[model samples]
Target: MDFEEKPFLRECKDIIEGSFGAYLNLSQQIGDLVNQHAQMVREAVSKLYSLLILTGNHSKPDTGIFMQLLKPLSESIMAIQEFREKNRASSWFNHLSAISESIGALGWVTVSPTPAPFVKEMTDAATFYTNKVLVAYKEKDKTHIDWAKAWLQFLNDLQKYIRVHHTTGLTWNSRGTPATASAGAPSAGGPPPPPPPPPADLFADPMKSGPGGDDTRSALLKELNRGTEITKGLKKITADQQTHKNPALRSSGPAPYKAPSSTSQPVVKSVAPPKPPRFELEGKKWMIEYQSGKRDLTVSDTDMSQSVNIYKCKDCLVVIKGKVNSITVDSCTKLSLVFDDIVSVVEFVNCQNIQAQSMGAVPTVNIEKTDVVEVYLNAKSLTAEIVTAKSSSVNVSVPSANGDFVEHPIPEQFKSIFNGSVFKTEPADKAA
Candidate 1:
């Protein structure tokens, strides 16, 4: 794995563990505080409105004061989401500065009873949250933002509370205590406990039956070859040993002959062969398009005993050829497959038919250009770019598009490509 992927994988593991759980607990605590404050504000607003209604005052009071107060609260929410969407490349130190500014803007909108202390607490929390996020952002750590968002939410709710009570202490959630810290925030102790390691055999070899008779094909041949050699060698060794043995002169010498102690058992050591190469999937259906002239071509599946295969990394076999009929190519690593050409031709004079099948779920095919007609499909939804053609006709019909099993007609120009190929199918069956 690359160094960069380490952090992402770590973050994914953290999520699977308990980091998300802590964030949720903290979020609820913060939401409760905010909820209480909002309720109070609503009550106050209602009472004032009632008074106006009772007095029959034709004039509206300056809601400007309330609007100004609500503005920062609303803007804070937007900023939080925007911060999350911020690219991983952005500097978190600069982020801290912006968050500080937002907190200052929010401070001016409401007056705290214990103004000095309240401001200090609010600023401290904001700075802490910002710094936490910055650290995570700079390191490309994802969990910090998740925790930050929860903290930001807590702060937002705290601000709402200040708008009402303006003096009530907003206690942090205790449930989110890190292993070392009483709160979800990191502590000054040594680094957090190392995450649990993934299973040792996570990538163990899998049992499989691939396309064609790929399963027993190689093993059968190899074992047969080994058995033949072993049998021949044993026969030769036995004949030589028998000829070298001295006949016992029982009557003349009255002696008994004994075989050598070391020769009693044959010392044969068996070692396994190296693992097979891996396969990867390239664009399975290489659309042999003919733009100006017919591009004569031939496509053929390798014989069952000698089928080709698609690979992932240069060695990891992602798909076995001949066994796989219709293949859907998606985001794949090493997007190329080695092929031993059965036949190579590029002319409109001749074409070949390749029989293929669709198994399990049909893989999704993403068509970018609309000018080309869709020949064979098994997907329920098909999207393309071309709707109309200028010189040549482009036909689009979704046989499976109507939820029916009927086969669609292949245009005269493209019938050769779709002759024996089936609709969509699962990618794992082909690739794994």
Candidate 2:
């Protein structure tokens, strides 16, 4: 019985070893395929950059050359996809995806008829994707990392070439002076050849041109119309291509990646997580709230000018400067708002213990469901609408009809909750 058990255990050991060996072989094959794919992508990017230079120099790209280069690129992209599908759970999936995207962007640029203007854009996009791949693998995969870096350098060189030699109008072949001119001047007695017939135009006005007479004006008009139509068609094509450029922008599921337009800036989408109410302002943080004790927020003119949106904040002293388009504060408690040189529309709702001052333009102020509101504005015009405030105090200085400053107190009826003096008006000159 002991001998029989020993034989069975040997057989089981052999089976397990064989299975492990097979898995190792498969992994080796996959690794080889990945390297091959990366090599193909590198080659494609190189060829594409060469072709772009040719195009920028006014030389037409050869279709045969493009087809030859594209074949390997397409193969690599496909192989990457198949591998990713087969090993969906592998940690390398993200890196592989990023590599594929970079290659796809290069491929798109390669086939584009007018890619010179987009060279920088495509190169930047490729760099972005390749960096993502490097980050995913970290210190692993040194070969591919080096390859990607080299490719990026090549792209940078190509971008510089395109920018320096870009041509604006239609490219014309150099017409060496006619052989006759080099040989000798035309014979004085020989009649000059008749001017070439005007080019045909589908929209030409026949009645406008008389026989045996030059119709230069009519021809110019026809050319202008044709140029306009061509421009419109080109614009439509550009718009359509932009729609497919960024996969992140598409409402549908992820698709093959393409480079963003070189002429346009990239759009960033932000999704911020909800935060607990607090008043803290430091550096670039938006939400301001007091955590333990009193705090001060001194916003410079440059900071105010750059802020596009201001949200809820409380329990701190806020000094605003410069101009903001609009500002909205809601549900804040024990807040002090000071305006140094603000030019903005401001709204406050359900806020308590508020103080506001305006030294520049008196922005349109809208208040609702607030208590203990105070404002001091030295402005040309003061416009404010308050829905409800328990206690409100206001001092405004406005220029009189004679350009002199005058102070006026806000009407008692303006404060609905309870108010002794809601507004105080002073002469603008005296306030200054």
Error (Å) of candidate 1 at residue 126 is 26
Tens digits of per-residue lDDT, candidate 1, 1-432, equal 322133322332233234333545533454543333223322322222222121121222123322322332344334443443442122232243334334432332234344335545665545533543443344565544554565455444434444443243211123332122111212122123212222222112245332234446767878788865757655344643443364543344544677779858888799885445323222333322211111222234433223122212221222223333222222222222212212111001011111122221222222211222323333422332211212122233444545665534323232222336764432222211
**What TM-score does each of the candidates earn?**
0.16, 0.26
Task: Using lDDT, give the best candidate's number.
Answer: 2
TM-score of 1: 0.16
Error of 1 at 5 (Å): 52
lDDT of 2 by residue, 1-432 (tens): 322133322332233234322323333444754454454444443333333322222333233332332343345445555655564233343345444544444444342344455655556546544554454335766655654555555455544433433323212123322121012212122212222222322222344443322456657777788965757655344654465685555766557688887888778789785566443332333334322234666656455433312345656667666665344455777777766443445656667767666666644665555666766555433554332333344434456678675754444352233256675543333323
Off by over 4 Å in 1: 1-23, 26-61, 87-432
lDDT of each: 0.32, 0.45
